[model samples]
Structure formats: structure tokens, C-alpha cells
Target: MLDTTKYEETTISTTPACQEDPTGVNYRGNLSRTIQDQTCQAWTSQDPYQHTKTPANYPNAGLDNNYCRNLDMRFTAWCFTTNPGTRWDFCAVGYLDPKCQATPACQEDPTGVNYRGNLSQTINNHTCQAWTSQDPHEHANTPADFPNAGLDENYCRNPNIENTAWCYTTDPETRWEYCAVGYLDPRCQATPACQEDPTGVHYRGLLSRTIGDHTCQAWTSQDPNQHTKTPANYPNAGLDNNYCRNPDGVNTAWCYTTNPETRWEYCAVGYLDPRCQGSVV
Candidate 1:
């Protein structure tokens, strides 16, 4: 049960800000009104609209004072309508013009030939050396030489047909290194264009809890439970952290439970689609 008294202590008078990202997943605004000009219900309140999304469960999702939020990591900010007839609707918030926003980078770049994003750091968190400079690690990949390669400033670029997006780093010992530039576009949040994970073996998202609300144990840890599922055991499984994954071909993604009694449990990592209305059930 939620402490409804917390709602009484809150107040929101300012209008919400416009969404900044391509998708409103980054929207941290307080837009309490719906597109139909209907007031939104408090996230903690289930009087007219019964919702599973609450501040208690999603503390970092910006659920405050009945303001609009995307606690479920959806493509847009939304809220339950106070109107008993309506369940919920997308907020009437404005989005930043595409021209004004920087182009999002792709997560995967098999070759550094097509990369144009502004990633100025290497995999070792080293700042990139300027292409214009002839410092410790000098190279001929410059904006003046290869003008079409998009070599600008110290940003990581693929001047040649390299393996992946790499840059000349500031570290003298480690002259150049590759980068793991993640996808900024929300549409690429899931596989098959944001659809459900068919087998859960390919699931790589950061869901770290079990369906029973127990915290997942680290893949490298064997304190509460000793398990063979680990990065060393399955290098292809991407088992770095406690995030849910199915390396042994289970029905869905599951994790080794932190509880000593319960060895493992399936995670409620539902359909990857941001707009999906279905659950694991």
C-alpha cells in the first residue's frame, strides 16, 4: 500500500517543458494535462485510474505531483486521465524541432566507414587527440586530407575502412582505441524495431530484477548462490552485470536471485516495444 499522505504534501504550479529528445522518453516535464485538455490523475492514486506505475516502484522516473512521465521507458510521456471514462492518453507536449536536435548515433557500426557521430572518447575513457594536432600519436587522417570522412575536431571518425569507430586517444601508451558508441535513437531501443524478445536469449536490455521483486545477484558473484552462468562461462551471452538474461535457452530472461533459498527466477522483462500493451502473461 502507498502512503497517500505524500500526495497531499506535493504541489505543481508551473507548466511543463517541451520534450527535448526525438522520442519523449527523456521528457522529465510536469505536464499534468492530456491532449484532450483533461487533468491527469496522481500516479499514487488509483481511484479513477488504476495503474501499476507508481513513484514507490519507479523512484527515478520523475513521477511527481501528477505530472506526466514515462516510468515504463516508453517512447513518450503519458499519464492516467482523471476522467473515469478515459484510462490514459499522450500528453499534448511539444517536441524540439528535428533540425535543432543533433542526429542520434547508431549502436552498431561494423566498420568505421559510415560513422559521423561526435564521440570524443575511447573505450578506456580516454579523451581523443585532435586530428589537426601532431602530438604523441600522429597520423595522416585529417580534415584537410580526407574532407569527406567527417573528421572534425577530436571527435571519433572513420577516415579509412577501419574495423570499427576508433580515435587517436590522448594516452601516449594507448595511441588509438575503438569506441562503443551506443544508440541514442529511441526507435532502436528494442530488436525488430522495438518489438518483444522472442526467445529472451538475445535480450540485452538493463532489467536487473526478478518477477517476484527480488534483486538479481551479480553474474560474477557466488555469495548467496553459486551459479555457473557467468561471462567467463558464456562469453557470447553478454553477462557482465546482474541484468536479466537467458544463457541456457529458457522460456524467458531470468537471473540468479539474491535470495539464498531461491536460486533463480524469471524476470518480468515484457515486450520490448515501448507502445506494447501486453505483459509476460
Candidate 2:
């Protein structure tokens, strides 16, 4: 028996036919016309898997994904991984790659020197006239030869120039002359006692003896009974009378009127009399 379904290699088409036309010939043209036509129809009816699976041609594939997204790529990825907001583009750019737009590139003075931030006159060329900070006395116009006039003792004594008594001169002669005779001159209001004459009679020793005719005097005779004439020159003379009377009262009063010149007279207590008589017998 002859097999009508026998396998024939020539019946199948190796080249795919055009999907748009069923009667189109396959590119190899080795298949039966019917098989070619049916293959073309089937290919036209089915959706192509390659067209869906293959990626499209993109113009900027090499660039980072976040380049057009307004955020740094690394920061975006970090935010995504850390569960942060993806909308914070500026913050992301600051965190990943900070731009110098907000922050200045340099902090220097007009001369391109680094600023020390202080306003010193010595370093900044600021004169006392231009700025008061340079002034040692805070802009006071004190003269260059201004007198200090510190603690003048003469000025303390006399304060006014018109008075002609101010003692502000620095001359040594003037200073000595002003202070001279301050102790001895009674006009000096503050003179000290020790500065007066030390050996003068005003400061002599104390008087020890009483002054009177009864003042003790020495006679030439040693015996108390001997009659001695009063010294011809007595310091303060009184009646010249002498009497021998026992001051101890051991003997009775005696009167010897042998001669008026030889008579012995006893002077009364506190009196100098020239008469002597026996106890008024």
C-alpha cells in the first residue's frame, strides 16, 4: 500500500513568510505554496513575543536615573533604602554632593588677606584722629606738654596762681625755702615742740630751795654757842639780833646783859628782833 502521509522535508518552509500577506513567498522559497501561505497567516494572527520582551531604544540610558529626577542618584538611593522622602531634592544634593552656591568659596578682606575679625589700630592703620579706638585717651585733645601736676605740696598750701602762694615749683631751692623756719617761726600753724631750742633756760632744771631771809646759810664759826656777826652782805637782811636759846628746851631761858654789845638776844619764832630779856620775870 502506498503511504499518502509520508514525511517529506520539502513540504515544510524554513524561511518565515511575511506576516502581512498570506500568499507571500517565504524568503527561502523552498516550501509548498500552501504551507507558505498558512505559515504567513498564522504568523500574522499571533502577537510577537520578541517585540514585547526586548527593551526600547532609549536616548539617555548611560546617564544616571536621577539625573532628570532633580535629586542626586546616590542620595536618592540612600533615601529609598532608608525609607526617607524622595521629594527632598535639595537636601539630597546637600547630603551627597554639596554645591558651593549657598556657601561662599572664600572669606577674606578686600586685600585678599584672611580676615582676623578684630579692629586694632596698630594693625589696621587707624589713627587717633580718624577713629577714637586708636586714641590712648579716648579722643581727648590733651596737649603734648600737658603738665601732670601730681601731688604738689605747695599747691596743697596755696591753690591759686593769682594768690602768688602756690608751691608747685620743682626747684629744690624753692622747696627748701618754703619749708624752712616752719618749726621756729611761730607763724607756722603746725610746728612741733621738739623742734624748739633744746638747751635754752626756758627748759632749765626745777627750783629746789625756798627763797627768804630764813634760807640756810653757812657761818665761819663751828660752835652753835659762839656769837657770830651776820654776814655784812646778806642776801635779804633784817634786824641783826642773836640769842642763845635751847631749841630742844632742855635748859631755862638765859639773858646775859654783861655788855650791851656782848648781850645775847634770842630771836622770836619767825621774827628777827635785837632785844633779849629773861622770860619777862
Candidate 3:
């Protein structure tokens, strides 16, 4: 019997210091070989391996030719190797520090969650109150309450499922406000988290297909499968098109399956780890 493991990663020497990207999302260098020294395969070609992650599907992942990219938002950027024996491997890339940036120019935050820019003012020209202060705007979105929300100073952030990055305004009348501080650049948005959202309500990541590689049914349509989770009903649930979401508060983000037999199914949510596969309907 033939071994059927799709990706069998090989252990190799440590990548040279010159090639290292911690986040693996913003490494646009020319390091075209995997850590195992295998030449990277062209993203457009499926000669050695027939894969689903293509440039056409992930236009923002910077899948230029064959350079390693973190399309799945993995620990780092990786690529399909040209060597038929080896399936894929991580590459040497640099983690562009998110704190080094001064302003929010080309920084793309699709979900507005990973925004680490220093945008402290609302669209109405109101200075945002510090996350630590509660003088005028006494709310629970403080550093003490949500530590990992990047509640530093008063930078706009979408810490907890807000429409976009926003902050508590210093203006007494207007307690809080949303900030227009994302998707300014057409380059590529920041990579989303690789874990499944527990509530699946705030999962704005881009995984349109289902776990079984089936195309998801658009949320706007009530075609083959009719259900209550529609864009009109759940306007704030990010129920756009065929993208998967847990608007009804399911265990995880799911979408109405295009297959009439299967009404709906959970999505992979960008996680491709072989160990944690989700169940299919």
C-alpha cells in the first residue's frame, strides 16, 4: 500500500540568520527555497503536487510565483517544494515588527483585530481616551479587563468583535466612537488568526469553502437550503456571501453547505493542521 500522507515535513538544519520572518506574513524577500533546501514550486503549477491554495483564491497572500507565503496564517511563511518527495516546508523570512510602524498607511487589517497602528483619533476628529483612564468614559474595555486586546494608550482597536477598530472618546457626550484606521493600502491585509473562534460570531477570516472542500452557500441566498441565518437577519454577524460564520451561536464558524443533502457544515477557518480536523455534516 502506498503511504498517503499529503505533507510529510522533513527536519533539517537551522535556517541561516539572514532568512527569518517571525510572523511569516510580511516576508516579501527572494528566499525561494525551503529550510530543507528544496527549490520552491511555482504557485501556479500543480505538477508535483495538486493543491487547492492557488493565487486566484488567495489574491492578497502575495503568492507571487512560488515564494513561500503564510496563506493559512501558520507559525511562519511556507511553500510547496519542487522536490516530488517532499511536500512542503517553511522558509527563512523576517517578522516585520508591528510596533515599528509610525502611522497606519499600507497596513491592512481585514477584521480590524490585528491592527497595531498608532491611530488615536476618531473620524470626527476626537482624541481617543487612554485605555487606562475612566474619567469620562467608564467602561469595561480596559487593560485590566481584556489584557491581550493591545489596550495600550488609546490606539484604536477592535479588541472585542466591534465593527472596526474603535476607542472610547474623551468627548463626554460621545462616549465612544469607531475609527477609520484599516484597509487603507491595497497591498494585503494582515493575516488572521489560525485558531477557530469559540463563538464563531466574530470570525471574519476568509475561508469560503468547507472542510470537505465543498463550496459554501452564500449567506445572502436561501437557495437549495433555506435557513434563518441571512444577511438581513444577522446584519452585524458578518454574514456576507458564502463565507462561513456562526451567526446562530453555533460551536464554531459554519456556513450553509451548497450540497442540498447537507444543510450546513463547519469551516476549517484557515487552520490546515492535520491533527485537528472538524466533523462534516
Candidate 4:
């Protein structure tokens, strides 16, 4: 016996959509291997969305490979094709299209630890309720951890460390204590710690608070007596004063040392304040 249903012919229909940008060129990958891609490459490499660049030709670029399934390090969405019926349909997210493909969840970490990485993150949002992850170190924008203020001579500071505070910036020229906000905030506002100048910071070694891009030099601990003014220990024997601080107390107090920096050096800690005592007292 033959079933008539087997002979019934069915028409295949595929839903098509206009190629639109869910995220701009910034969030898009290279063009979908087309003449437009070659045309874009021939233009300028500086801006992806230059004159010759066509958004419709390329697939979306993103920090994350997930196409609306997983959140980025900043809780933002990546991939996310605008074309609904296309092969690159957003998975896991189901149907409702996200407005911004590269926006972070509008949420904040309840524990201050999370704040160390996302200071600029928003607080209390419905869309961002599900996102929560972080990088290893701290972010320097929140008001949670009251970063300890390190003196010019202090080094090896970390937010994870029990007693240490955020290692603020030091003026290479003036050698004054200042926060990332650019002030003499001995009590740095509780915020994410910046690793840019992780080592050499304001009011640190030499004490002058001038802006020069220099990575901070890490040491075992901030000990004044430990770092003696020896030829080997001091950075530049003829150039800068390489000595442990005086007084030996933690937090900006220079330890006892004989080789103080020059007295008139405006940027030196001892030069800014008499207590630093540029010369061995």
C-alpha cells in the first residue's frame, strides 16, 4: 500500500533579512570576504568606518567570539548579527535583539573586590542582572577600597595585600603626593587601582610629582632601613638619590638612610617637606 502523503511535494522557504549593523564597524569583524573588504583595505587602516568602508558587507567584530551567548569581560555583548533569519542568528539570547552590541551590563559588583576592575560600571540595572565576571587586578574608578597612600620611597603595593593601599602616582619632577584624581589625597579615594604606573608613582622615590610615563619598580617591601644607599642598590649613582627613607615608619615615612637626594631638587620628597630631610640627619 502506497501512502499519498509520501508523494506530496513541499516547497522550501528561507526567511531573508537586510544586512544591517547590530554594532558599528568597531564591533564588526573583517568584511565577509568580498570586494568591499578589499575596497576597505585599500582605504585607510586608521579608522575602520572610513569612507570606503561598508557596514553591510562585513560581519560584526567583537572582543568576544560568542554571538550574543556569553558576556565579555566588561559584561558587554559581542557578535550579534542584525539579520534575523541569517545563518549568524544570535544563539542563547533567543529573540529580543539588544540595542547596543558592545554595551556592558548596567550593573555593579556588591563586593568591593569587583569594584577594583569596573569603577565606571553602572549600578542596579535590569538588563545587566545576569552578568558578573572580572579580571585579576583591581579597577581604579569605584569608591570601595580606600587605597593606602605610599610615600615616594614606598614600593610593592597591591590592593590584594592586607595593609597596602592603591599605589598612587608620583610627580617625577615635583615629587608631591597626589591621587589619580590629581591631588594630594593621602587618603586616596576608595577606587580601582591603576597599574599604568604600577611602580614609579607620585611622592614616591625622589618625591617630585611630575608626569612622566615610567613603570613602577617593585621591591620586596617598603623598608627604609632595608634599602641602604649602596652603589649597587641606588638606581643612578650620579643622577638620582637611591636611598631608603628616613624615620622607618610605614606609609610615606622615609626610612633611615645616609645618601639623601640633593636638597634643592624641587621634585624630591625631602625637598618638598623638611621632614623628609634630604640629607642624612
Winning model by TM-score: 1
Worst 10 residues of 3 by lDDT: 10-19
Indicate the worst ten consecutive residues by lDDT in candidate 4: 123-132
Whole-model lDDT, candidate 3? Answer: 0.64
For 1-281, candidate 2 gives per-residue lDDT tens digits of 86645434333222112111111211122221120011111111122211111112323222122121111111111111111221111111111121212222122112212212111111111111221122222322122222342221121111112221112223322221111111211112122122231111122111111111111122223233344333354322221222222222222222222233433322112111101111111
lDDT of all the models against the reference?
A: 0.63, 0.20, 0.64, 0.23
In candidate 3, clashing pairs total 6
Where is model 2 more than 4 Å wrong at Cα? 1-86, 91-103, 106-281
Candidate 3, residue 241: Cα displacement in angstroms equals 35
Tell me how candidate 2 scores on lDDT: 0.20
User: Across residues 105-164, which tens digit of lDDT does each residue of candidate 1 receive?
Assistant: 444444656766555655434668988887978899888999988877887777876656
Candidate 3, clashing residue pairs? 20-93, 20-94, 21-93, 21-94, 21-95, 22-95
Q: What value of lDDT does candidate 1 attain over all alpha carbons?
A: 0.63
Candidate 3 C-alpha error for residue 174, in Å: 34
Cα shift from native, residue 80, model 2 (Å): 7.4
1 against 2, candidate with superior lDDT:
1
Q: Give per-residue CA lDDT, model 3, range 1-281, as digits (tens).
A: 76645333221113322123333666666778865567999888897988978989988888868887867654346788889876776665532223223333335465578777665656444578999999788888988888888997888887886767789998897688776545422113233323444445677754565544456888988888888888889999888767778788766777888798888876644333221223212
